[model samples]
Target: MSKTLIVYGSTTGNTESVSDDIAKILEKNGHSVEIQDAADISVDGLADQFDTVLLGCSTWGEDEIELQDDFIPLFENLEQAALKGKKVAVFGCGDSSYEYFCGAVDVIEEKAGELGAVLLGESLKIDGDPEPEEVSAWTESIMTKM
Candidate 1:
């Protein structure tokens, strides 16, 4: 079984809910999983213990892409996470009406690529409320890569 770590930042609980759903699916698949709230995590060597790392954050802003408040610090210090050649996946929740829907996911994917992490698949961008089946499917799709 793969050891997985899910780090997420949420304001209104939407992103947190998605994280829970993903964890449930991964656990049911027999993967050892741990969920960390971005506000409480230390980015230093964050991915060292996990075979797979999933990042989830919410995008905020009217004309700019602002990562969820608590995630900004972690995002800025991602290099300390030691993601080089590690398996990483990105996901986020956002409003589709905005110009940059789930923009945080795109930002993270780019950063992860720069860090040389092996991205599993396309990042899951949830618009508005998250659906259980959708989260499950996305989580399952990445299971193959792990």
Candidate 2:
């Protein structure tokens, strides 16, 4: 079984709800999974655990970083070269009418790429009210790759 980590930052709990669903599916598949809050995590603390990382967040105003207040500092503290070769994926919740749907996922994916982490699975861009089937499919696809 693959060891997986799901880190999420949600202001209104939408992203957290999604992460919970993903974690449940992964655990049901017999994979060891840990769900964490991005706000409380530190790069140093995550240095040596798990092989797969799933980041979830909501899109903030003006297409800016959703959980920038938390993730920004932690992300900046990491050594770019140190994160090379890591495997990661991103999923975000946003309102499609906001003009920047899933903008948080965009930022997460870009940063993960820059850190040299191999992108795994699709970058899930769930609408304001994401579809269960879609989220299930996303979870299934990631599990297959894992």
Best by TM-score: 1
Tens digit of per-residue lDDT, candidate 1, span 1-146? 79999999999999999999999988998999999999999999999988999999999998999999999999999999999989999999999999988899999999999999999999999988998888989998999899
Candidate 2: residue 124 Cα off by (Å): 0.5
Per-residue lDDT value at 131 in model 2: 77
TM-score of each: 0.98, 0.88
Off by over 4 Å in 1: none
Kindly give the stretch of ten consecutive residues in candidate 2 with the minimal lDDT sum: 74-83
In TM-score terms, candidate 2 sits at: 0.88
Highest lDDT scorer: 1
lDDT of each: 0.95, 0.77
State each model's C-alpha RMSD to the native: 0.6, 2.2
